[model samples]
Target: MNGHEQGNSRAAPSRLRIVVDTDMGVDDAAAVAWLLSQRERPVELAGVAAVWGNTGVDAAAVNVVALLRALGREQVPVVMGEAAPSSGPMSPIGSLVHGADGMWGRAAGTIATCPKDLVAFYRAVAAADTTLLALGPLTNLTRVAALAPDVLRRFARIVVLGGAWRHGSITPVSETNFWHDPEAADRVLAERLPIVLVTRDAHRAFALTHDDLAALATAGSPAARYLAAPMRAYAQVTGRFGEPLNFPDVVAAVLAVEPAAATVRRSALVRVVTGTHGLVRGQSVMGFADNERLAMIEGGAALARLVEQALAEPTLHLGRALAAILAREPDNAEVVLAVDAARVRRSFLCALTREART
Candidate 1:
């Protein structure tokens, strides 16, 4: 969630040099495929990095390659990014939202493979303008910055899709990605670059309904067919059994290709609250700094349709589709409130920490 943002324009890029960092959950699969299929605004992969969330980076790396191959983008290198070891023991979160293998109790075998010299590939892109798409924790980016801060600075900007201001999906005020590694979050935000943040308050607004999934089941594109299974499986896992898969990682992908897809953005100064060890730990507190500022994308229905349209037509110029999708935006202005019980689960975490100390 820690990155930088630039101008909000719909003018498509001829090509984008990018480093995609992911936790490789179901929405992550969707985001990766969408990035590959972006027709007008093609994304050129510098590298794809996996972090330890949603799943371990080891498994995340495997899934990254699998999806890239599904879209016939197997040439992109997959890097198991460097991150400090977890400071505390915690149960894994991917299995709950994205199933055990990170896909439907998946019956199919993967045809993906990773290269051994991923770091070499990363160093090769040092001089170019790179945009980082963070679909998970900031650990990988922080680690990369330490190795070559200038290489990170060369990034034109970053488009991030996680975090929250007042409500915490992980704790009282922490979102999942930021909560998983607040130290990394703090470090990455400290770089002070222009960043576009799609936080939890805005992300949760893009919901999927039964109609959206129905469209995917019949869209007949390779992307549609490939992504439909896991999306449906995720719906079932989240007990939205018949509802649309509401994960919003794809929102970030669309914004990457077309920033105009989001109509509202508030610039705010921000800070990350670390080491509180209770409800406040890992929270990204906003409106605290005067000079440090980032644009927070607002949540709405245009986002939902943009995602659906992207799935329906993977290579469609999102800039063109925005006219129609943005028209339907008003209907999607308010998303039905859904409760995330993750905080309830973390409440028991304090007991474990106490036991560890005792």
Candidate 2:
């Protein structure tokens, strides 16, 4: 079932309206592209909010605009956010992973403007049923909860692409996103939002290999060229001893739109503890399950299908079945049309490689 069909079958009004909160890394960019292209949830993409993680919000905002423009989604308001928290050591940059200025080296000017307040911004956009697809650190979100608890109460759910039930990408215990902002994580989990935890334990189920990417690059599509730079970057940074880096986050976001299309296990409460001994700091713990287990299982073909559909469809406009995005985010129109056709061509090649393997 699609996200909405799985939620409730009785007289549904329309598709799920979602806002992506991301750090604008290559993986996050992939996730955003994938989510926006989905027909299942038919994400509205109210706005792209930046947080401090792979890159700071300022840089992230610029990168978001660039990627959106590349995808032909420039009108999507790329909102700048807190460069750093009110009081804390700034989070370290994953420049080696995302490049110096976030978009694999593309530079663009970001106007010095920001939302008057994030809590208010969220309140204005989110209804009682909006979903927040969070693909970065929880700093902005956590801050929203603290300043205006009621504003946060309106969100229907928060799907976090950070943390790990056991295995971690950054350190033995902590996932890089959570480790960067543990305080925010604590606040997020504490809030009563129905959290769909897409942890490392779950994300690892989907892997995009080098050979997989290389095949696409050889295909000579516009999307293939787009995927080349970041795919190479990802392989270089997160890899261990020549092994390719395992990227499950972007694929996880794709899976979220169609959970039925994926194999996912459920957990009652997923929490992180900041202070601890060696190899245990920032580790994610599940209360009920001894270890995280799959509640749902989607085959590799299902994921491949999701990617295939995204690549096939035009990212320039809202799906005919769902007009909410086009209606609400009218500003995104030019960016949608301005998408580099070549980049889209490359994306198709990447999907073709995935399709062939599947």
Q: Could you say which candidate leads in lDDT?
A: 1
lDDT of each: 0.63, 0.61
Worst 10 residues of 2 by lDDT: 329-338
User: In candidate 1, what are the lDDT values of residues 1-358, reduced to their tens digit?
Assistant: 2233345434555777777888888888877766665454676877787777777666677788777776677778787664333356433766787877676544246644555343464576544477777888877767766666766666676777666865567766778887887777777776665467777765655566555666666665666677788888788776644433456687776666666566556655455676647877778766422212212222345466666878898798766655443333122111111223232112111121211110
- How many residue pairs collide in each prediction? 4, 26
Give lDDT tens digits, candidate 2, residues 1-358.
Answer: 8998867876533776677887888778767756655344456777768877787778787777766766667777656665774346765657867777666765356442545367667877777667778888788888888788877668776677767756776787677777777667766776747676677665654556667667756754434455567777667766744644555456456544555433445545455666434465556655443212111122346545655776688673324422332232121000000112223333333343434353
In the order shown, what is each candidate's alpha-carbon RMSD? 18.4, 16.9
Give the clash count for model 1: 4
